[model samples]
Target: MFIRKLWAYLLGYLILVIKGEHPERLINLAYTRGVHLWDLCWIDAGTLTAKVYASSFRTLRHIAKKAGCRLRIRRKRGLPFLLFRLRRRRMLLVGAVVFCLILYCLSSFIWTVEVSGTRRISQQKVKELAAEAGLRPGSIRFQVQRDEVVDHLLRELPEIAYAEVNVGPRSRIRISEKQLPEPGVGYCHIVAEKEGVIESVLTLAGQPLVREGDVVRKGQVLISGEISPAPPGQDEQQGEQLPPRQEPRFVQARGIVHARVWYRFYGEAALEEIQERLTGRKTLIFRIKVPGKEVIVYGPREVPYQFCRLRTHRYKLQRWRNISLPVEFVTIEAEEVRHQHVRRSYEEAVEMAAERARERADRGLPREAVTVRRRYKVLGGDEDPVRVVLTVETRESIGVIRKFRPENQTDKTGGKEGV
Candidate 1:
């Protein structure tokens, strides 16, 4: 079929209007005579239009005469006629070729640069570094050293832990950078995250404020950032007769404070519940959307399903830079549905309720937590809705870093937020 179309296009074709009393006879005669014609359709009561090869169209004129039909060319198409028309506009042809050449040349050069993933480094600074490695806009794509550019960026920015340069189509350069971890706080302390008994305390650079077996409340400071030097030994003081004055020293203390924490959860499920179910009937609709309006291009104009659930998805056309058509395609699917009530037995309801309760009880439990104990209980009898309560106990580190106030910016409440 494609070969036939190509043959017609190369030899040229014509849309001829056959107007006469017996146009149908003209079509049959042409077919029997081995004259190719396509896209045949009735134009009106006495007129018919169809495509015929240019050479065969000439013979069609002869057939039209014998068949009592008058034939006239309505439109001319295909490469032969196109070239004939262009012959009269030589300058236009030259200009089109020149425009195409210019486009091809311009597309070969890089036009845009995009930098991403740099938090501390500015885009302009990064671009400058990239330019030194031959990655700036207007540079030849084949000439740019992608790996060298990445290595250069990493070399110039010590904080950058990961660097990559990706060259995209249309001469676009993208730089991805990942910076190092942020520096530690100048001053901070360890505080209890929840109300629990202190399991143990290990002070690395802070004053121990809580000890093992000591009960502590949420937000209580387990290790103080401030440290006071122990009083000089008595023997040293006696030998000197006078000891140097010692003042309490403040430090950015750090330590680990672990405490036991507990959580509780409750859940309820009915023995019978109503649920929406699909009826297996569905309709898919397509639409074209402009900036402010939309028109349905396919499917039923009016919604087909009365009791149905709808899901809509939209897709925007592929774009280049900031240039894009203000048009979008949307597809909507409506599935017919109905509501049904499902009844469950006591065992089924209990199992469902327990699962829900377990999810809640496990909420916020750390991976390192060791489950010391768990308890479950039904709060109500075999009612439609049965209530269940779940309690869990786990042993895990609860130490949370709580920053200490600077000496000059001390809060009036004496660090009340962290106790």
Candidate 2:
């Protein structure tokens, strides 16, 4: 159907309104004569409307005369008519072509340059370096060599480990910086950071001081850095004496100690409370700010609602490099709100209080902690505000490194070594 309509448009067509004794006779005669007519609509008992191709309209005129119907052209359409109109307004055609050319020319040049993944190195520095490599704004997109830009960035910045350049209308340059490894702390003991019952222990390079299911206190050593070697056995057959005991060795302790920890939180919710919310009715105020004065473009002088929320956003014209305009387009959105007193049931208040206690506990809990169980308790009389005590049990790693000097050690200053 679209192809047929496009064909009619390319060849030009006319909308004709036929009126007289019998307009249907004209349509039947045109159909029998193999002259196609589409979009036929009966206006009344003696009038009809239809569209016919410009080339076939002559044949329709003859058909109309034989059917005793007079035909009047309603509208002329298609590319031929458009060309004729443009032929008179030559400047409009020229302007349209020039606009298209401008868009095409602008698309070939880079307009904005952005730099990402930069931490130690400043974004401005990276952009300047990229500009030196011929990847700056206003440069031709096809002429900017990505490989050269990447090489330039890596060579100019010693901290940059990797670099990538994407060339387009808004060119983006991404870089990865080199990271130095942290120095290691030698000879340390792993101690319990919190008081809990040990659920499990994984000793990687340490002497185990406590086993699973053992109750430990805060600052207690869960894994010791001092390791003692086993004593030599006696030779009973030859009656030989036992060897001397070896001294204990102190090394860094490394391990994971998971323990079960408990937390208690208290919360309360009033049975009667006031709640304020937006009524979804809003008023907008637009203004222009220039230097020291502001002028309102539209909207009321004062807010309509007594109690409302105001959200203001300011926009300015696009700046070039370091130059910025003082004028700003400010839009203020005032949303009307109403406050009402709400009375919740005793059971509802209790549930709300419990949820609040649970949320508080969750916020205080560590991200790596896994919840194991929860218990809730209600306090106060039924008439009082719903007060709840929430007890949460969780399992988490409780081991932390505690540095200590070796026994009987001395520093360069002739002072005894300390933790």
Candidate 3:
């Protein structure tokens, strides 16, 4: 504290000492007092500038009068560099302090949190869990470990099948939650809704139709719903009718089958975004706060944008976080965004659409299937968005079955042929 005060005082008034060419006679007269030497000059053929330290100006005058030399003393001037810096000292200091405050605030406050991919689990519940894990508004971002928080949430909530946490720039935290699997109503059969070549086959349940190296078309069965007779002749005798059974007879069965199947899919997406840049216009102000009191730093002023955003910055010791300094600064930034519709390249758009098609197919198909071959091509134009045709081949063979009863057969005949 003492050093700071001393520096402040010295800084207010700088010091410089200058001397001239003179020796013995000037030293002797120094003992006397009360003589003024505000204006004195010394003439030296070789050098004029010298160094000297005296307790009073009187002594300097005495020494000048005794010697045949001249002396002059006054505050130094003509230093425009020093003066300019001195004039802006307060501003520089305040700006530096405000910058540090902003950094501290960023480390302590949670700016953003995102929740995704949860249909069964409520977003509110996810937020609640995050808040409980120290991720609420104004929560300290520096003190929180995103991965650790996610793990904790997953452990605490059984409904969350998967969970993830992301920490972004400017103290933003994002949370991702996945819900647990619900009980299946019954065995869901994934048949060849559409068709393609069977590159591979994986049987999870029921009988398989086409094997690894087989080609199939639309409506072609990769897995059969019908059961083979115990033996070729073991089948019960029945009246043969004209036109063999065209409809597939469903038998009671449960299992999963994976066969490589290929189908076409399409997708379309728009690419456009807006950005902002300052046009050489900026303003700043300062504010102070007392106990339970508030006031504006500078007078109210209109900003550039219709929507204004205000950010508050504060300062406190790292170790003692509760004790905040009285000084505070708030910055308000107005941003204007212009909308633009950017269209992707024909090739790029086609590729994107094809990828989307493959993803959609995966969603529609059984999970047991694995993708093998994919082919995509553009078929249409811009404005309407280029048409992307995608053929994706995946391996999946799933089927459903139902048991046939004698009652069902009798009902088909209307009881006319029943005994």
Best by lDDT: 2
**Candidate numbers sorted by lDDT from highest down:** 2, 1, 3
Q: How accurate is candidate 2 locally (lDDT)?
A: 0.86
Better of 1 and 2 by lDDT: 2
RMSD (Å) per prediction:
16.3, 16.2, 21.9
Per-residue lDDT over 259-286 for candidate 3, one digit per residue giving the tens place of the 0 to 100 score:
4565667776444324344444444433
Model 1 lDDT tens row, 27-75: 8999999998889899797898899989887788888899999988889
Regions of candidate 1 where Cα sits further than 4 Å from its true position: 1-184, 229-245, 278-282, 290-294, 302-307, 316-326, 361-368, 380-384, 406-419
Cα-lDDT of candidate 3 = 0.51
Ranking by TM-score: 2, 1, 3
Q: Would you estimate the TM-scores of all the predictions?
A: 0.46, 0.49, 0.29
> In order, what lDDT does every prediction score?
0.76, 0.86, 0.51
Model 1 compared with the native: what TM-score?
0.46
| Deviation (Å) of 363 in candidate 3 | 6.7
Off by over 4 Å in 2: 1-183, 228-246, 312-331, 407-419
